[model samples]
Every structure is written in structure tokens, then in C-alpha cells.
Target: MKKILLLLTLAICSWSVLHAQDDTFKKYRENAAGKLKKAENDTTNRLWKKGATLSLTVNQGSLTNWAAGGDKFSLSIAGAFSGFANYRKDRHRWDNTMELAYGYVNTTSLGGRKSDDRIDLTSKYGYQIGKSLYASALMNLRTQMANGYLYTDTSDIFVSKFFAPAYLILSPGLDYIPNDEFSLFVSPITARWVFVLDDSLANVGSYGVDTGKHVNTEYGAYLTANWNKKVTENIVFKSRLDLFSNYKHNPKNIDVYWTNMLTMKVNKYLSANVSLDMIYDDDIRVFENKNTGVLGPRLQIKQVIGVGFTAVF
Candidate 1:
């Protein structure tokens, strides 16, 4: 009887220890699951936000034995895309944006021509320094997608091509953001590199690059301002302005780039857009006329108006 009791007592002690260990493991698992569920439910801790907008406009016209003095058949298509990805956590922030636009037109008279082409990308990182202020670093790239030509009465002249005249700018600056709709960035020390990858253009020293060189470097002061706002329930406006003054060259002649876009939402899928772009680079030379045979710097302007299908994502 004593031996049997001793054996039973040892068995009972082992079972108790096993049960206690299982309870402890169950509690730990429950705690971990609760923490994970809380983290999943909390959107305030989300680190990244992204959005994009797309627009496509198409125009077609046909003339059937009509004396309107127009092309027999004409078609034009324009597409634009804008997107942004932003991250914010604690005092650190990162923002990236991309914009692309291209347009093509084909007609009986003009044959085929490119109306517009643009590619722009920007990335910025900042650390909060004070209320509505940040110490930031920014990098920007600007280029075109296709070859550009200058049409003349005699013949078309080859001008720019993909990566032929690309601009890359890097700056460490201060950004002021008092509101969500507007921001201004300024930097006294900025480095800008102009790349002319085409051998022909580089040989001619196009776009301020040295003769026979593919890249030109400049030290400059840079300023950029951005604004985006809803003018009304259906209308939205966006604008950006950039200015740069080269310290090694003619600092008095500042480079200017400004663009404005106004969008009116007609419905969920239809919209109207008006865009204006202005640029002035002292190094960019333009031919005055065929007769004058003079090339000089001039202000360039472009305006576009269209109604198109719009999508947001």
C-alpha cells in the first residue's frame, strides 16, 4: 500500500506541473495575439500614403469635301499621369512624386507631329526642425521621352531626344510648410548637372554643356514654390515655380521655370484641363528667324486646353 501511494503521489505531481506550464504558454500566446490585433486596427500609425491621377484626351476630325481649309483627317491624343508616395513617422518624412505627359497629333497636312513630352521626378527627405519647418534634402530629375524637332519652312531640324538634355538638381535646404496646400523650399548651395548624352548635341555644346562633353556641372542658389488648392467644389488649381542662379556663370541671369494647371471636374469620368508653362534659361538659344539668322536666348511658353477622361487611384 505504501509503495502504491508513493507512486500515485509522484504521478499527480508530474500532471500538475504539466498543467501549469500549458497555462503559462496559453497566456503568452493570447498576449501576443492581442498586441498584433491592436497594431492592425490602428491606422494612426500608418507610415505610407500614396495616390495617383490620370488623364487621357483624344480629338478627331474629318473633312469630307468641305471647303473649311483644314486637314482631311486629323487625330490627336494626349495623356498625363501624376503620382505621389509619402511617408511620415515621428519627425522623419519622405516624399516622392512623378509626372509624365506625352501628346501626338497626326493630320493629312502635318503628317505626324509631337505636341508635348515631359518627364519629371522629385524626391525629398526632411527632419522636423521646428513648427511648420523642416531641414530637407531634395533631388529632382527632368527629361523628355522622345525626340523633338524644330519645324521650318525648308525642313525640320533635329533638336532634343531622350536623355539628350536631362537636368538633375540636388540641394540641401529649408522647407517651410504652414499649410497642407502650399510649401516653399530655398537653398543657397545647390548642384545642378546638365547631361547631353547624344554625341551630336554634345559636340555642338547644346544646352550649356562644354563642347565634346556629355555633362555640365553648375553651383547655384535654388528656390522652389509649390501650391495646390481646390478653388471650388469642382475646380482645382496647381502651380509650381523654380528659380536658379548660377554662381560660376552669369548670376544675374536667373533660370526660371513655372507651370500652372487648372482642372475642372465635369463628372466622375470627364474633366477639363488648362495648362500653361513658361521657361527661361539663359543658356538655351533660339533662332530668331530664317531671314535674321540670329540665335539668342528667348522666353518659351506653351499653353494647352483639353477635355478628357479622368481617373484617380
Candidate 2:
């Protein structure tokens, strides 16, 4: 009887060991299957690819009264069409981007009927400086077509002349992003030189008498801040502020300006924007009159509301 009990105990021990081994094998198989499925899904979804965007904007506005008279108020309409294609590698680097934009505007003011058109071509190369830091440089070629008249008084009239000016600007800047969607950039130096393709407008001064050849080489500093927040799955809030100052040959002849824009993204395909721009020029004010010379601060303000369609590919 004692021998029989010992044999039964040994059999029970063997059965328990086999069951444990079987359970361990089953778990290993399940884990391996899960890993294989994940690998297949990753292969099917290609997350690294190139993208493109096309956009259009239309805007209209009027100026209210304070001083300077021709028409008590003015009507202006403007539109812009832009497109870009870029190849993104990794999270913060891109090789290059091809950007093209065309803009046109028409204005009827107290001064007279005015119109302007511009074509801009830009190419950019970007590099990642660090985890949340990026550096980029852009080359731009711009051509402008303008026709207008400036009325100093009821007696003084300046005729409109059709002219086109072309220039190339080189801009390099660094960005500091604390998070995924917020960034601030401070570029202490930027240089802009006009090639002087055409000298038609150089010798003619409508606002003041021609005082020989005026220099137009501009060197400046610029600062920009951008914020992007997701309001919903399909909506977003975007805001940007850009400030710049140009110091030319004459220190007092500097130009200071600021532009602020807020955009509400209705969807991936549509958005609306409100923008404000201000420009102050010391030289333009100094040469206001050919004889007396009114030298001081000159200010101009602009406000606009616009709707646009944007597409990304």
C-alpha cells in the first residue's frame, strides 16, 4: 500500500510540470503573434511622405477720415493665390520647398485710382538645429507692377507711371519651439538690396521734387512669434506677429513696421483671417513737399478681413 501511494504522488508531480510548460508555450505564441501583426500594420501605413499646399485669398476694405483729402473714403480689393510643395524627413527637417505666389490689388481713393500687382517666387532649405530648434534660409525673387497718382492739394497733381521693380532677398533665421506648436524667432540681422533693374521711378518723385539719386539699400532686424492651438478636431487658432526695422544710409531715414494676423481654421480646406499693418517712414515724411520740407514721422494704417481656401496634398 505504501509503494502504491508513492507511485501516485510521482505521477501527479509529472502531470503538473507538463501543464505548466504547456501554459508557458501558449503565452509565448500569443506574444509573438501580436508583434507580427504590428509589424504588418506598420508596413502597410507609410507615414513618411511629401506634402503640398494650395491656397487663395480675397479681401476688401475702406479707410476712415482723419486727414488728407481726395475722396473722403476709399475702396480697395485684393486677392492672392499661393502654392507650396515640400518634402519632410524625420520630424524637424526638410530638404527644400518650392513656393509661388501672385497678388493683385485695386484701390479708389481720394488721391486717385491706384492698382498694384506682384509675383513672388521663393525657395527654402531647412535644418534642425536641436530637438526643438530649427534653422532655415530662403531666397526670394519679387516683381511688382504699380500705377497710381498722389494728390497733394486740389492744384497739385502727380501722374501715374507704369513701372516694374525686381529684387532678391536672402533671409536666414532660427526658431525656438518650446512645444510642438508654439515658436518664437529673433533674427538680429537681415539684408535687402534692390538690383535696380529699371531706373524709371528712381529719378521721378511724385510726393516731392527729384533730389538726385536716392539710395535704397536696406539692412534690418526682424522678430517673429507664432502660436498654434487646436480648438477642436477640425478647428484651430493661429496667430503671428512680425516686427522689423530698416536702417538705411541716414539713421533718421529708418523704416519701422509691424504686422499682426489672426486666423481661424474652419477646416483643412478653408480659413478666415484678420490682419493689421502699420508703417512709419522718416524719409518719406521729410520729403513730403518739394520746397518747404515737412520732416517728421509718417504713419499709415491698414486693416483687412479675408476668407481663403487651403488645400494640402
Candidate 3:
């Protein structure tokens, strides 16, 4: 009788413990479900849609004790950011974007150099005026954040500095926005400002500014065309083209800026990207060889590729 009573007590304890665990699991499931439903409700009621993503990439190569010769340790780092805020309600829309990227590379032969640099911001507001036309006001700013150099045998020479060659444009225009992916804006009245904020660059009249002047102002007619599309389940493409004709100067010489990007998503946080950029400004002069004395307008082109990390919300 004593042994039987002891066995019954053990069975009762085990059953009680199992019942407690089952209750705890159900409680956790209910809590999770409630939170998910709340999140869905908040998303459905939110007025503004916004998101941001940042990515970092690093590359390194080292040479240790080896028979053959190789480069001394090389290193490179790159960071990129992209974000957007869009507000839409009742035939009104305001769209904004910010894009920034910078990169640096170091090698035994060249020491250190800026491999890539960019800063671009855009804000456009529109009100519906027709089936596909909208009255719009747009502002754009473009610049770089680091010192650019002209590398030569003697040494490196400073060609650019932070905000030393900034471009700011403002225009009230008409936009033809046929769909979510494309927009064409035309403005007959536009004001453009070119700033050389660095003292050294301003004194030397770099980036088309006159010697001893810190800023150059121009009145112009401007047009910008942009397109963004998803090519496949994992691939996306984006492109922008800018054209500006100065009304006070040589109007026929239009300044052109074009940029393109293609991104392939591997997952929610991993991606591969490629970018191309080109710029042509009539006033800005560039020398192919730094040691040479002459200067002329040079068409600039840059290309970049790397695997990246991304996040959005």
C-alpha cells in the first residue's frame, strides 16, 4: 500500500507540470497574435509612408610571408544610404529623397584616395492640375563631403573639398507624372547657385567660380527626367537625367547630369548593386594631366559595383 501510494503521487506531479507548460505556451501564442494584429491596424491607419536603408561594404587584401611578390596590405571601405518619405492624400503628394555615399581606398603605391563620393537630396511637391499634369515646386542639392585630389608624382593636389562645389537648384514647374515610376518636370523659371565654400578652392576659382568670388548665380530653364522600375523579382533599376540651359549666358550649351543604378536583392538584408554616373558642365574645366597647364571641359564618368547590406521599414 505504501509503494502504490508513492507511485500515484509521482504520476500526479508529472501531470500537473505538463498542464502548466501547456497553459504557458497558449498564453504566449495569444500575446503574439494580439501584437501582430495591433501592428497591422497601425499600418493601415498611418498617413505617411517612410523608409530608410543603409549599407556598408569592405574589402581587404593582405600579403604574408610568401615566395612571390604582391602588394602590401590594401584596404577599402564604402558606405551608402538611401531613404524616402512620401505623403499622399486627396490628389496631393509630396515626395522627398536623400542619397549619400562615400568611399576610400588605400594601397602601398597610392597611399590613400577617395574612390567614390556623392551627396544628393531632392524634394518635390505637387498638386493635381490635369489627368497627368501637376503643378510642382522642386528643390535639389548636390555636393560632396570629402577632399578630392589630383594624384601625381610630386604629390597630391586638392581639387575639391566639402561643399566647395555645391549646386543648389530651385524651380516652380509643371510635372508630367504619368505613373508611379516616371516623372518629367519642366521649368522656364529656375534659379541655380554654385558655391565654392572652401577658402583655398574659392581663392583659386575652382568649379567655375570666378577668382575671389565665393558664389556664382545663374538664371536658367531646367528639365529633369527620372525613371524607376523593377525589372524582375530580384532586380531593380533607376535612372535620372538633368538638363539646364542658362538664359543669361550661352543658352545653347546645356549642362547635363545623368545617373543610373541597378540593384539585385539576395534577401532582406543582402544585395548586389551597380551604379553609373556622368556629368558635363561647360564652365567647369578639368585637365587630363595635372602637370599640364591647359584646362577644358571634360566629360566625367564613374562606375561602381559591390555586394551590399540593406534594410527597410
Candidate 4:
């Protein structure tokens, strides 16, 4: 009877030890699962982000009896607004941006004139097809917020007004995005429309539209390249290039739009910036001097430099 009792005690002890080990393993698995869930939540928030920045630049000059003859009692104000929304998660991405800017200058010789005006919005959606290639669709709009004029000694020639020469583009393309700083997209088919909402500008056909027509539509092949990088500790550089070739018209003659912006940060709230914009459109006719120059396509360029108060998010 004592031998049988000893055997029973050993069996009970072995069962108890096995039950305790299983309970410990269950608690460890639960802790590991909780940590993994928290990590995943953090990653999701990092993938989706939103940001905005506003900058205002001002320039003023006062001359009581200055010798070096400049524009006496001059004042200029420029403002820029930029916002962005970006998302990337598991082979899907959506990127959106909006930019608005306006500037005015008043001087003794020039009187009051607009130095800059622009409104731009873009949205791009992509689904990854390969490691670095994506099927994408992009929509973009470019326009002005206010009237624009060219100043001369004789008169101020009305050049552009709100929606007078607005451009809208929709493209379905293949995007190559190797990293966050650079992107390239090419579309064999694209739809572009030029709208001249202002009646006066439409009558004169200012920018590539037919005379008295309100809208011009074209189908084309489109390509765009974008790059942005921090060149130095305090300097940032960004550039974008766009090309389009109309299928119905002269396909060899392509339209080009290129822009570059450089920023140097002095502090958290102060910065200096330089911008360059260039455009070439075969349908738009520009003449430097009508009396001595031929009427044809001319490359258009604009440049700006300023120091300003800037806020970024």
C-alpha cells in the first residue's frame, strides 16, 4: 500500500508542473501580442501625414533726399501658402498639395503693380505594380487668383486675369518612385483643357485658345519629374519639370513647364527663398517687339527672390 501511494504522489506532481508551464507560456504570448499591436498602430500614424506652411515677405524703402536715385517711397508685399497631405501604406499612396501666392509692389516710377500671382493644386494616387513601379493617376490645375498686367510707360497692358488662362490636366500613368525625394511619371494618354473664363481675354485669345472661344481641349502624352532634397544643413532645393505632346497637332512640338525653388533657413521663423519658372507652349504666340520681331513661340521666364517670415508644419 505504501508503494502504491508513492507512485500516485509522483504522478500528481508531474501533472501540476506541466499545468504551471502552460500558464506561464500563455501570459508571455499575450504580452508579445499587445506589444506588436502598439507598434503597428504607431506605423500607421507615421504613414499618413499632413503639413502646411505660410510665408510673408515685405520690402520697403524711404528716400528723403537720397542720391543713388532709386524708386522713392517703395513698398512691396508677398505672401505664399503651401499645404500637403501624403499617405503611404502597403503598396498604396495618395499625395495632394495646394499652393497659393500673391504679391504687389508700389513705387514712384511703377506706381502699383502685381509682382506675382498663382494658384496650383495637385492630387496623385498610386497602386504599386512592382517594387518601384506603380499604376497612377494624377490631376492638376494651374491658374491665377487675380488680375495680372504688364507695366509700360504708355499703358498697363492686361496680360492675365483670374481663370483667364487656366490649365487643367488629368493623366493616368506609370509612376517610378524609388524613394521619397524623387518621382517620375509618364502617360501615353492625357487630357488637358485650357479655360478662358474672362470674356475680354477670350475675345483676344491670349493664351492658346481660339478667338472668342471659352475652352480648348487636347489629348496628349504627358511626362513629369519631381525632385526635392536638403542640399545642406540649412538649404533645401526642389524642382519639377513637365512635358506634353498633343496627339492631334504637331506631336514633335512639345510644351514644357519647369520650376525650381531654393530655400535657405536662417532660423525657425526666418528664411530666404529664390524661385525660377519657365514655360514653352507652341500654341501661344508671343512677340518681343512687333515692329522688328516675328510673331512666334517664345520662351517665357520669371524669377523671384525674397526674405520672409515662414512657418512650417
State the lDDT of candidate 4 residue by residue for 69-140, as single tens digits: 787689999999989999988889999999899999899977888888889999999999999999999999
lDDT of 2 by residue, 1-313 (tens): 9999999999999999999999999999999999999988675454334456566675555556746644434444444444444445565443333444334455564433433344556555557778777787656565445543444656533333332234455668886767757767666677755433334445653222243343355677655565767766655565545554565455444454454556677877897766666766443442254565754456756666767876766
Give each model's whole-structure lDDT. 0.94, 0.56, 0.90, 0.91
Return the top candidate by lDDT. Answer: 1
Which ranges in model 1 have alpha carbons more than 4 Å from their true place? 1-35, 38-45, 289-291
Q: Per-residue lDDT of 1-313 in model 3, one digit per residue for the tens?
A: 9999999999999999999999999999999999999998786557478888788778899887856977778998889888999888777889999999999999887788889899999999999999999999999999999888877789787888778899999999999999999999999999999999988888888877889898999999999999999999889999999999999888998999999999899999998889899999988775654567678777889998888677655
**Candidate 1 local Cα displacement, residue 156, angstroms:** 0.7
Candidate 2 overall Cα lDDT vs. reference? 0.56
Better of 1 and 4 by TM-score: 1
Scored by Cα lDDT, where does model 3 land?
A: 0.90
Per-model TM against the reference: 0.88, 0.53, 0.82, 0.85
For residue 273, give model 2's deviation from the true position in Å.
Answer: 4.4
Those runs of model 4 whose alpha carbons end farther than 4 Å from true positions after fitting are 1-44, 290-294
Question: How many clashing residue pairs are found in candidate 3?
Answer: 0
Give the range of the ten consecutive residues with the poorest summed lDDT in model 2: 206-215
Which model, 3 or 4, shows the larger lDDT?
4
lDDT of 1 by residue, 121-168 (tens): 999999999999999999999999999998887788898999889999
